[model samples]
Target: MANEVVVVMVPFLAQGHLNQLLHLSRLISTYNIPIHFISTATHNRQVRIRLHGWNPNNNLIQFHDLDDPIVTPHPIIPNTTSHPNFPTHLQPYFNSSLLLRTPVADVIRSVSQTARKVAVIHDSLMSYVVQDVCLIPNAETYIFRGLSVFYYFCSTNMNLGRELPFEPDKICQLPAPGESISPEFSEFIKLQYDHQKNHVGNVYDSSRIIEGKFVESLKRDQVNGKYHWAVGPFNPVEMDSDCLDRHICLQWLDKQPARSVLYVSFGTTTTFTSDQIAELALGLERSTQRFLWVLRDADKGDGSVGVKAAGPSHEKPLFDNYQTLHSTCRSVGLPEGVAGRGLVVREWAPQIDILGHLSTGGFVSHCGWNSCMEAMTAGVAVATWPIHTDQPYNAILLSNVLGVAVVMRDWEHRDELLTSVMVEKVVRKLMDTEVGEAVRKRAAELGGEWRKSMADGGVTHEDLNSLISYIHK
Candidate 1:
């Protein structure tokens, strides 16, 4: 076709990351470029099954399977199963040390020669691999922060020591672009502060703890002497490509007034206990605000002790409290007026489309970067309630600093359920007063700028063109 260019996306095997990268790849492929989505066999298989097939039009797009030796005892080929949970499909990928210099160098040597040129768009968390991957003469690597433009700037500025620029030895009240960041109840800031006290300098570096435990094992693959370029997502872009669903959520939006609907989702991965779900249901019921929610069958306990599937991993079993209450819910279920009082629950949702709807004024999000990006681009203010990982950090940035998102009840525990009163209070504030208006105005302004950035002569548009140019070089 138009000088085939291969764009390999290496996400952290989570739905949030996968969704964002897939969207980016679709954006590139729309320009008539070929995309050979190289992912672990298990994940690729899952994609095929979920989408019914990889190629819908049978045009310039295709999927290529890669072998990870460490996946199973078979190394190159292993049996993968179809599991309900998505992360289970990623288990095999966790064993391969793609970040190690030797393997990465080998992968480049193998793939680089196949295409006229190769461009690698990797997650920022996988920065260690950029060293070796970018070394190939024809290779150019990009670091996708996948968060907000401002958050990216903050992360880059947040250094480790005197040698670094803004390294805090403790939970210092660091300043944002325009305001002072207050730790308050942000578990992210609290944890970062705790981390600083326990381990000074390199506050962002959690290599030792996270490695082997998660994809951090990839860090072992870093090459010895290689230069890695770090580029932040400081430039915001509204992904308005035709690749997105156009009318999925518009009808729903047409029925609601501006700033009335509260969007609630805990992202693709974060699940909740049945009790937590009940609490959340009760909360939404109490709030009396119109809402759309994506609810998954997740428990507060570990269920991964036995099942071995090829798809996403299941959450831990429910806590003891849920074990007893689960039966109760099974019998009585949701309150009688809950559904009619303005709540629509679904297993899966047209998220990107929903956020962009004009009627969607506020989001109750887990603060995943992809969700944040979508909300920001759509001009929807957020109601932050982060669960784990970098979500807490994202939530803090959105609420305390950005002044766009409002925090509900800080991260809740199984024992500490978020009551209906807390939910109603947050929802009322998001819908009724000046604070809501201010947040809405800020989000709209930000979204408008982002939309402009992706136009023909805009900053993000130029950045994308430059990315293509780099690949051709």
Candidate 2:
């Protein structure tokens, strides 16, 4: 008898990457494909906790907690121990490949011999281990990128070890100019870009999950030579109860008029300097619009949120930014809301749910690919405020290419932050002007188009089917 296709998922340790894989795992399981969701001890627990009721008893999906007692006999899981050292510094993409080397090969070998036809689906960052993963009998490995297609395309095109043709100030403006990008910024992008050099265009030439013709145009490789498939805009996965407080946020939305409230959130792992936060606070207040703001103090960067060229070369620049921003954010105090129309939430909020609500007309976002996808898929217009990494690239994509979002603040390579004036102006423009209405309508229409893309015979659905056929072949 032919065995069922069993996909083994090995996501990196980041929440953003893990969340995407979990959602994708849920998606593939609908086809009755069994999955081996593997992670280190802590990450395995995190994923299991995320899927609380989804896979009880492991009937269809097996959870491999590599850090669990049975799998990890050692008293301590090697990578689970973390210190004040930030993630961007740890360089896990490079280290994790080495760490999972034997474990990944062992798991695939075990699964293939006994019951199922195994396929290894890992984070794009883990591409270094794909070659080893492919060593398993009849096994195939595919890279799953959690970032935007625009960001990916830019990375592939950039010349490593060479100066960009554009000005250093125009790093974010590959096709057009908006913000300044530091030399270190491109360095990080290059690091990620270089990882895919081995398998990206050659290995299943997997499809990117982003959905849009504009992104499609940037395709550098032949139809399937590089991007064999387009897998998304993956619907924003719902957060588990532990990750968010839904009832309070949803109840607040229930009382607002349709498309009247602005839903503001940067992302799960991102925080700004206090100055930027204060500017945002003032902007939200000045716009006179009903809004929901989800804030996390833990993510506040010391100004430079993890863009480093090497050891500590980039620290000083970031530290300077943090000090300036801290004083500014500290000096200002947010006023009480009138009639309790607006709300400020410090803990997590159900971003996907909040964006999808009828009352959410606009999103004040940091333009992370997932958040941007969520807002666009929900047909909610965005007031873009990109902070770092792929965010600025995504902001450019939304504002310049798709016309679904309005860029609130241009990204910068310097020590400056967005002032209240910029924030208030953009908020009012998004909430009170005809331009905002047009963008809002366009967002909804784009959302409808994306919905159609997910339907039968749609481009994304076809690619998904192609992946299935390849697996079954």
Q: Give one digit per residue, the lDDT tens place, for model 2 in 149-174.
A: 76656654563333443345456454
Q: lDDT tens digits, residues 67-180, model 1? A: 544434211111112212122323333334243335445666566777766676665544444456645766666555454443433443444222222235312423323222
Candidate 1 ranges beyond 4 A from true positions:
1-5, 45-58, 67-93, 96-111, 124-137, 147-159, 162-258, 298-334, 344-346, 411-416
Using TM-score as the measure, which candidate wins? 2
In candidate 1 the C-alpha lDDT for residue 443 amounts to 78
TM-score of each: 0.65, 0.76
- Error of model 2, residue 192, in angstroms: 7.6
Inter-residue clash pairs, candidate 2: 207-229, 209-232
Where is model 1 poorest over a 10-residue stretch in terms of lDDT?
198-207
